[model samples]
Target: MRKNYLLGMALMASLSFYSCDKEVIYVQDGNGVESVADGAQIITLQVENGGDGLATRAGRPLYSAEAKQTIENVKLWICDNTGKVVYVKEISNWNTDGSTVYTTGGHGRQTTIELKDMDKLAAGSYKVYAVGYSNSSDYVLTDVTNVAEDGNFSENMVLSLSNTVGEEIFAGQMEFTVETGKGFKKPIVLNRQVAGAFAYVKDIPFMEGAKYLKLVASAQNQSLVLGNFNSVDLAGNGSGNDANVKYVVNGENGKSGSETYEISSIDLNEWFTAIKDENGDNLIDAGDNWKNPYSSEGHPTFQKGSAFGGEFVIPFAHVDGKQTLTLQLTNAGGNVLRSWKVNLRSSDEQLDQTITCWNSVSTDWSTEVTDESANIYSLVRNHLYGIGTRMNDDPGEGTDPEPNPSDPDDQPESLNNKQELVLKVNDNWEVIHGMELD
Candidate 1:
């Protein structure tokens, strides 16, 4: 059963931004109007998904195996000019796990979300702030019921990064007007709100009696709030210095996960495989562009036809500075073999043949980077970064056993820089939406 979400219940909505037939569809009564419980005619918004919703498709990068467009619930706030939240409505459980299916001729799921409160307010201009999220519990609820014009709405209602990691945060804001008789009819396309960062572990040979590999992405905390803003992040607020938010991949055999702590990992042994050619050859491709991205002769490439490995992803709120990813290549006895500082902003043009570095991270995690072939320092919402690496026939170094994790003969090993692991983006990673932090 769908729970009652709206405290001051007024409207209901089901929207799909990218649709086929029509942008919006209204399945109304014979009178051509949805009658509300309070008899305040419904302001309808109809939408449907048109293919761009789920990003996981053929030839997509490994980390593309995530939910790009899945909005479970939405919280709406209709605020007046002075930021006074005059009306509030929460729509719960719209499209989830094929649970509710109101389709449009099988193109994609059709959605209809209705609005109320027009029967009370006078005709005027209003700002509609809508936030959609997958997990309801992650939202930091601030009562917008009686917010004052003295910036109370902006301070109270917000979404934080502490709990929303790897979760869906779809948000949108639109300005609309309400006439004397016509309630309110406007479309809200609540798109993804968090920037996507994913890491791929490839070309790492299953050698050296290696039992496990641990990968951790450490970033500054997302302490800012999503308060009546399109996105979060103060320009120079030092959010990039918090160094607390993290995404980890510790799965066995080079597997991956999407949790805050031990969210997911890779199975190292099962993660890597030699690229192949059409003539039943391994580590070779027909086009010659697929396999050898860096050098046609230096080392072999990873990711065969069927699958790839260590597809780790972290959904993050926009932080201020460059993020750090610490990779611990361990042996069977939990010995630290080697460390790597991944340059998430590794050149993407070699992958897409279009743009230079697009992310906006300053310093590399393990080793600081001065300049790059491509660099978009800041992480923005609705972007994707598919980052990967290549490990050659070198066994690098190793440390003593862990628990009391020791170094190689009490010797500390430096992290392998991104320039060493990744020379250029692979052709397989076609769409470079965004980049990892470091």
Candidate 2:
């Protein structure tokens, strides 16, 4: 039951007409998709997810078990030379989806889906787009038009992860020609599209009186679009941290002057896959766990010591830019003692919202910067930067916990004090060891 699908095109995954409920469509010459050619070109496709999701080292070719499994659907597409999507299919539930057994690349016993429609297409240039994800309702494909028509790739394929938690998304694309018997042979390699983070604090002399310490990370922008610019926009729909944040303290008789105020910070627990712990997981005890580069994948497995540290995964962010995770020392009365902003940024590029970066040491936090690859100072996708810092130095400035992007009193600076941001990066579930503040 096939027909010419030359109708209006929308790039949404949940389009009623093009639902991802294991639907398949192809292009044919006649008005109606009836009698097909004798031998339609069918291409065998398999996927390979290199070394567990994240790496402890740069470009470390380690695969991840999270990527190995949890692939609920492989939404694959074939676009014409001009970016007009012609063929579409959702390969899922491989057990009965007419897929053959595939055990070569990543996890054993996957599937080898036979792709059609290439031969039906006239010989010319074409591209293959594939996105593998765990959930069907977590992503949105928007801000793209005309390309879905007969236009060029003038716009972006906005894969909005703004509202999504740390959901692991893998994408692969390739260009090829529809000529003779030749077809793509190499396995499509899917790479991680998010980053990982965690914090730890130790030896905070006043924490003995403050009782407990916690880490709060705030991102100025939520990665709205994906492209060369890595497009982003202000978080409005529930915000990057949502309108209401967790662990909030409305400055009631607050000891720390600035600490007693409305705080709008990204809830690490809500946005990230796993919030280190309800309080914090002491990362100092992370002996063997610290050894693994992609340890962020095993959130629950991390053993907590006496320090306030734990790990979670986040979207690809410019940590050195508008995103930062700060350490806060609070007394039992929910009063702030001293705060230190993980100085990763070189400038004051913050979100449009009213967020402060808190007071850092007299000397701002600076890192050995370079390209995104070597700059463990920034938060990039498919990479991990383990933050092993010791907050044993004197508390820098004001105690207001709510970070203001426009605040000039206590601004962002280079890494000062003995606070060395232990950002050791690697590749999937890329591991960024927790930090420790004394």
Candidate 3:
């Protein structure tokens, strides 16, 4: 009896050890094994506006509409063709309001999970699942899609002006139209690039609370074409040098149009000269001398401010049901000088908005306004700069120049040197606006 009791205690100890060493697995089936295949590939998932799907057949990329809540904490994962887990990653949040929830990801809300190194992916159909957690909760929200061909289908387009740089200086205006085979929805005009591509959809006119339409971009006379798969930049070199170039529109449907214009470079030398002659003095001695106020970086200039203003016309074809249009600006340098955006609605109503960089440190850096036009709403922001009358006197007659008041405790007042103009268009085009420095 003593031997039997000792044996039973040994057996219990062994069972306890075994339980501690066992791995915990969560399985869809009531099996103890984790049923994940090795070397599986998972693709990125996309989120669409209005809870729509972003399949290519749907004609529009998936997107999340502008909402009051912020999206945050986007996590992505992948699986192989053989139903095995392969890879996982977390995405950085890109919203402005600091919300950690993610409304959309993976190819502008179309593909949720993008399979990495797809070239290495074996030729087979695979399934991808995406789980998104909102900023409000940790519950994993799931979205899934199928991956077939190892290539991308969507195309990207960009537009910009060479002469429009520095503070809000007027360049030109353009009108764009897009048509696709699939039905499109919930157009967005983005100021920044999406997924490594620039978008020109800003400060235009469109309908309010509409989901199916998006605007890519608008510029003086240039547009960019993008690759059908990756957002590779395409040249719109129509017929001219950099000083005066034209834009040519080409797409899968063979649509074509043109915009004519000239390029501009900034003339910093002229501005420096004007600043030195503030007191009507021609020399830069003593009181007239100022610190190096010129930029070593290149400035933006225009084609002699021609009296013959030009217009841009862009056309689209390949009408199926609905299509998404995108525009972008590339290789932008220096401070943005000025911009304008206008949108024309189907009801012949227009909406417009403009932004002018303000010189306030405490106040908002920009101002905005809205206006309406006939079938063409307009948004304009014209920024200007001027020298102030406050003068500075050199303390040593011809030595170190000091503030006119010469009080070491006094602070120099702020001044506006240059102006910039920017325009943006929301998905809703009902509001027209503009802004300027007072």
Candidate 4:
């Protein structure tokens, strides 16, 4: 059934007979109760969000899968030509019996709004503004007394991997002139003002005895102000050209092996574009502002060799097209040994795809066979970087063993006095043909 309501002059007298179910009331006329069109004019509005539901790169829903995230209520503000609000009305899922039922079914479907009472709309141009919430606690409506006195509306939409509950907010506006009898044609669609991101590091060589391994991005540790819906710096400051904005340290001790780190919380709209000052100012205008021109739709895919290095799917609320992201492999002391500057493609290809590190120098690692199915690309790189030799002997020349075993005397004669360069991945030693100590 079409939920209709009698608004304007009749609202005051009709409130005396309010019902607990919060159903719309019939507009009363001088003669008696009249049906819609028999007396009062009706204004219809349609509201919709972009798709069924926004989600993370891992395919997890951002809003409630059941569409319950959208609260069944909206607040409307009618303003005159001068932009001053004249009237305010809040239509909610209130029930006279105190048992409330709401518009809570449908995944990504448009909802409707109907307002009756053309009498309040004089013969002039007027503006109608509406705001709704996905969850009640996420936002609050205030002020809204009269045109001269308007209240402040607060908004809170938090997006993070850890956040499973939906907290989305939608808003729209329309302009219409009050005619003797006319209806609105166009509908309104609310735009989402936020984006999400997650990342994982794979096959990054951990520096041995280097304290700890840490993953650092060009933009990290930065907070974005939610009120500003449009800005190039929302993704981050181009400061990636100067200093790293964020860093996450691995809890495990640094050892020689292939490392993987996963993080699921990144706000694309949180702009941190200023060159971070030494004093660490949290204000948005505290430093030199350089806008980041990258869109949040894509993320960097890091690969040290043929294997995947790291995969990141970062989102942005604004900006468009391909974006550049830099991934760095840093030691606990803040030393970046290897970094990959990846240009993330615009589309689902950015999700669940592995990009090989184009700079990898392990041409022969693929041809070498190991006792176990392990990749020793990292081991070969470490050996060549240390010995100043481009190649090592075949597997028969020597044995590749773990360094500093419990019994030092049990070491092989061919391995004595030679620094052992070992590569480990998936808890197995990946012996390279030319990496054995001789």
Backbone collisions counted per model: 35, 52, 88, 17
lDDT of 3: 0.19
Select the stronger candidate by TM-score from 3 and 4.
4
RMSD (CA, Å), each prediction:
15.9, 17.2, 26.0, 24.5
lDDT, candidate 2, 40-93, per-residue tens: 444333432221123131121111112222345555566787777776666665
lDDT (tens digit, per residue) of candidate 3 on 1-438: 000000000000000000000000000111112232344322222222210111111111111111111233333223444545444444335233212222221012222222334333444343222222223221111221121233221112222222221110001111112122211111111111111001111111111211121112222212222211101111111001112111112111222343211122222222223223333333222222222221222211111110000011121211222112121111124322222221223231112223221212333323332322321222111100001110111112333222224332121211122122222211111111111111
Give Cα-based local distance difference scores for all models. Answer: 0.31, 0.31, 0.19, 0.24
Between candidates 2 and 4, name the one with more favorable TM-score: 2
Write down the TM-score of every candidate: 0.48, 0.48, 0.19, 0.34
Candidate 2 runs further than 4 Å off: 1-69, 93-110, 116-120, 136-138, 141-155, 161-165, 200-213, 228-299, 304-324, 331-335, 338-376, 388-418, 429-438
Choose 3 or 4, whichever is better by lDDT.
4
Clash count for candidate 2 is 52
lDDT of 1 at 92: 59
- Candidate 4's displacement at residue 352, Å, is 27
